[model samples]
Target: MNDSRSRWLALAVLALAQFMVVLDVTIVNVALPAIQTDLGFSAEGLQWVVNSYTLTFGGLLLLGGRMSDILGRRRLFLIGLGLFAAASLAGGFATSEGSLIAIRAIQGIGGALLSPAALALLTVIFPAGRDRNIALGVWGALAGIGGTLGVVAGGVLVDGLGWEWIFFVNVPFAVVAILAAPAFITESRRVQGEHSNFDVAGAILGTAGLFALVGAVIRTEAAGWGSTQVLALFGSAVVLIGAFLFVEARAKDPLVPLRLFRVRGLSVSAIALALNGGAFLGMFFLTALYLQQVHGDSALEAGTHFLPMGGAAILSAVIGAQLVTRFGTRAAYLGGSAVGAVGLLLLSQAGADATFAGGLLPGLIVFGLGLPLVGVANQIAAVAEVPHEDAGAASGVITTAFQVGGALGLALISTTATTRTGDLLAAGAVQTDALAGGFERGMLIAAGLAVANLVIGAVRAPRIRPDAAMVAEASAA
Candidate 1:
């Protein structure tokens, strides 16, 4: 009933909601084989099970954030949570590939609403100081661990229960969060202001443009970058985004105020987080491939290997909070990025004959440790200096940056690795050797991206004032 206990409880609910959303991002990967067997999905068609959710989630995030600012955060959070739970329940019973994909898309819509609203709530709930930094560290840790845990959980569920249990599992967590949310979390929106009309045109253009952009990026995995469909989508995205920017400049009220970009912390953090996300996801993708295809690990075995990663990230998050508290976000982020680059470089040394302990484990532990450091610092930096009214929009940009960047990075890494494998195969290499070589190349590319993150952090990162910005009213309703 007291303010302090209530805020922490509210965080627990929000973190649970966010963890569920993040879990869905990767939980379905391990279940894909089971899903294909049951639903008779074509190899190509099955990829959409993952792509549909990511693209839709990435595309609609900005709109969701703006809507949160217009509507209430608590209201949007509850609505999104309800939609997500219902879709997950429906997805468990899907008899056809089409039905499952559609449900996943709906889940993505829920995520777009829920993710930003939840993050914005954190920004508003914890004032700028040590408490907010600690809160964000917990958030970053859970988010990082969620991806790893998804694989572990998916493997266990798919092997123990049916694949449907993966979807079924979300229902109980969502129900608990939905029930507990209103008791602790309070409704808040952008303070009442003049020119309150929503920017419908900006919403349409911006959402459509982001949708097209993410679509083009996703298509690049199957269709080459130069393919007609990919090019057309890219062109459409460019024009629509250009139009959206033009409209926002002149609109009485913008869906996302252009001025928000001027916030040094938010802008720099978005870019840095994008690069960090790229490296992080690329590492995970390549490692998964290396473990399964190269080392002959089963899905469940590979998932278990990632448990160390989750553990390392938890410890790193605690250290990251201290680093941010003592030094600042910039110092912590730069340090983390450097460590991540080193981790990726170590992973690049893995060979066809590599043993898990000798080759893979060290890199996995190091990368995991560095990941949450970058994550926690960016989480704080992104919103620490943002105005109260635009907290939702700021959260949206940060998350969209990470998601879209991961998509782009994965595409690039996959292509590079595939091309390298093809080249090695042509040169008379064995299948496993070629696969290992390809994975090595991919890890190297990820390392390069991590190094790029370090450069961005060192050069462009904002020096955040710990006690300024991000304080907002948190009165209980």
Candidate 2:
């Protein structure tokens, strides 16, 4: 293939790898009931199916990103892919819940490794210009689409085939990407030098800390925030993460370079991504509940309801890249965030009698259309200007922000909904009405988060100048 054709083909491979990883995040959700029934999972124990993956993926992401930099991106990508595929296959044959959960955790590890390497590869593959913008736009779009599509795909696969197919489905995609990757993707990593230490202690602390933190966040949905186990985990996470920061500051070569934060727009983008994650991911969770419980949609019907949102996200992501290329990341982020907040506010008005067309579609479409602008912009801002050697690290940090942010957002939103529902139920409200009331309050909080993202962008988002490589593209345009 010619160079241009090669890069685009490589992007397809990388994006496919990432799509499978992200799809796993939510694909299993629709099949949870089926898995529970077949595998004899207890009501309380069933959550581990999801939590195991979340905890490992979120915890190991930074380490995986850094490892990709230390090792080669292609090498790590393949290794992660192999691990993920194997785990998925194993999961397909799992006869017990424990075995399945174990396999899912392994899948998380694979995802943590694959996602950043795939993104880092994009940074190197496309260069810093219109091409990179478009590439990242596709990457950002898939990030949103994978989550939404997972629901639809899950419902289809589960209904048509079986729950095992969810795990089995990953193998073919993984095999194709693995076979094609060598032909298109180039191998790249940090240069070796005198200061190329790997910061073993920092890695241990950071990984454990993130694990503890994510674990605590996941538990908060089931265990109240004040529960002894949750509190202890939270405390441990704070202490360990604090120590990791301290160690990184002094290390000769840290796992996460302290200086990376000084990169223009990075810190601001990280914060914004976190808020963006909290708002939109929370919206998805609540929206799913609203569709199923209030609107009386089956799993397939609810997943179908998200099709508009998914379509809007894909369109917005393409437009967002153009906006970034023309206007800049700051402008796109601010405008997009504002639109997203409006979408959430509209969603906040849905009541028990809410119809899909009147009450849900508008918000879903607008919200979907808006946040991906932030996603595409945030992604570009986070990684575009960073030194090539740190591309993996930069991608890792950005991805971590989104995952951690999503976890935090979902926890807060779910808790709010649960509390409101409980209160309404106690006061004699019908189940559907109480559920709707709770969902409204949850969406309102999500809207508030989006507004906060807008405010942050306005206040802190820096003006990003196009690189020299982009100048020719700009002049041509």
Candidate 3:
């Protein structure tokens, strides 16, 4: 094997940054209750703590990626690291709900700037042919593994060190990454005369619009879909997003070039990302809640039990990456998503008295297997078909879709499940049993989304590894 000592070290540093960003997703899951109680957040308000970060990260991703191209990835990466670390510290020491949410939003801005630059940096460092493929595989694996670690680590920390440690954990990693990133990696190319105007108006509209849309999805429990507040928010979301789209079409230098979607792989990958994010919402958030709330498991137990799912996901993700070279991206996505759907379906049937071993473990494992396969496939697909000039935008689309879809999914399906469960209980069903029904319904929604993702994968994604094969043939020649 060719020695890649320096490259491997670089990979380690980038992967640490990647893992830190992804880990932030579920690292706070076990601490939701603690945050809610300590901060005195309303039910709807609690979702904001999570959704605010996601919305900001998702909305600004295209801008962030493009900025890195212009400002330089290495500088942007370090700056993002510093900002994220500061935001994490601010969040950790939050004395009030408003402060925490504010810091979380800033953390998201930092995340948005960091993730794409890291990936792009990796893309530049890892040469084409086997090396690039191998690097991407490692990248994908770390993303999945990091998410799993978040759940387990979050549980342990929340129980032992208190909820603040969730944010505290990132400080050291950020400091290390900020210091090390510029040392090993060389700067990548930028477009010679690319348009430089950022869509500020579009940005404001998109962010506020997304917030409104997600708010409606969350407030369904209190106001119902018909309530004036819910209706108005949804309406505002539509109008604002629509305005942003209209503005983008006319802007000289659009924040996100609309042309990226023309690539088939980019479009489908973005959709797949959305489904992937939705699945996480169901798997990590709802699943955690079911084990804790209805099943009455301790937060620690709830977090610990998710290990199987993460384990399966990591293994399957690696398998999925290998399969991509052999079978193609399409097959990996279709097969992996279907397997995950089955897992979600199985989990949807949990009862209040169900044991983890007999009831949830099998499903968790199956779902876990599906996660990595589908996730990595989607990431590979996003950047594969597009030209190098548009790689960042294409990448942005994949991640943006993931966040937007996740927020929508979590807000909508979770609200539906919660509303139905409350209604059933109000109608005289047993409280425990009704909660079970809600959890099942929510899981079913996510499962259906997964199946739909498979459909999109089969329809739009290219199966043959034309690029990989061509690289091989060229080397042989």
Candidate 4:
């Protein structure tokens, strides 16, 4: 058990934990109908099963990251794993919709703690260079693959073993990760004298603001954007967020250091990551609907259909790391975004008459191919120049962007599709045809968002050679 071997083993454990976290995000999606039917969930209430997780996960991410820094990455990681595992078990046994949603929210809190801690641990363990780059590539690929695989696995599990299996499935992975983690992950925390107290007000304000914001976004489709409830949530979010910023600017030990945004790479990459998430995640949600609703595929069939997309994402992630190594982050971001947008455009043309090969496969493959390029590049850029002590916070910001973006993206795209479907149905179109029309329109919006990512990356992301001092440091290690 030499140092190098130990680090690699730790990476494996961390990645496994991450895969579970990512998997849960979309795994429950395919099981939605089943869960709803079994529990007698209202159409509106059904969305909460997913939204509860996203809101809590997104809201607590910064605090989790900060806790990892102040408390100890390994300690927070274990605690998170334990909590998540317990919640999953409870969810499996839940007989009521309220109980399930509560359990899911608890799971999100665990995820918020685990995800950033795992990423920060990786950044701590792997020195910057080819090793770190490769590790991040694998992590990014898993992020993409996990979401897609969730859809596939969800369908299989729900159809074969029932929807409860979705939660039950996480138990084994959590147990393994909890047992293996202590052996491989060494404890690391910020210097003791750096900060005397945590920024409690900032944490409360930020978390509450984010939760409100995401809740508002989630309700927009059902309540209408201008509804009183939605408007109140939005106003509260703005005020709370503004107050959080004010607190951060004045706090002695800020939850999120305001100065971190001074790093060009971190700021730009965060924005790009958000936009990329909006498009990529939105694509997944809409495509799944198109396959199941429009194409009339069963859960298993729909899951199987996503296999190519998952495979492509994994393959492209490997290549994406190399692209970043050779051409730099800017080039990789630009190239990936351009290609991904094109893929979405192709998907936007899908209709009722379109076949799998003729309609969906091409875009699925292309979108999958392009995802990792952006994903890996954005990841590298986000943490490339971060100070070691703030790695956890940085990781939190990145993860938060992805979670919040996914929620917002799904809400907007789903709304677009729903509205379009209503119009088509009003015009006397068949159900399948109306759904296809809605999906196509939604895909087009997703494509535009991807293009926006390309523009942002080109304008703001700095070009840094992979062989710079960071890689040199890893090579020396």
Give me the candidate number with maximum TM-score. Answer: 3
Q: List the residue pairs that clash in candidate 1.
A: none
lDDT of 1 at 316: 81
Candidate 2 or 4, higher TM-score? 4
Pick the lDDT winner.
4
Stretches of candidate 3 off by over 4 Å are 1-8, 129-134, 182-192, 428-431, 458-462, 466-477
Model 3: per-residue Cα lDDT over 131-179, one tens digit each: 7767776776666678778888888888899899999999999888877
Model 2 TM-score, all chains together? 0.84
lDDT of 1 at 404: 65
Compared with the true structure, what per-residue lDDT tens digits does model 2 show for residues 111-137?
A: 988877887788788877688767765
Write the number of the candidate with greater lDDT, choosing between 2 and 4. 4
TM-score of structure candidate 4 = 0.88
> What TM-score against the true fold does each predicted structure earn?
0.84, 0.84, 0.90, 0.88
* Distance from true location, Cα of 37 in model 4, Å: 3.5
How many clashes (backbone atoms < 3 Å, residues ≥3 apart in a chain or on different chains) does model 1 have?
0
Q: What is the C-alpha RMSD of each candidate to the true structure, in Å?
A: 4.2, 4.1, 3.8, 3.4
Better of 1 and 4 by TM-score: 4
Please provide, for model 4 over 281-323, each residue's C-alpha lDDT reduced to its tens digit, 9 standing for 90 to 100: 6787677667877888877788888888888887887677667
Candidate 4 residues lying further than 4 Å off, grouped into runs, are 1-12, 40-45, 121-141, 182-188, 384-392, 468-477
Task: For candidate 1, give the lDDT of residue 225.
Answer: 89
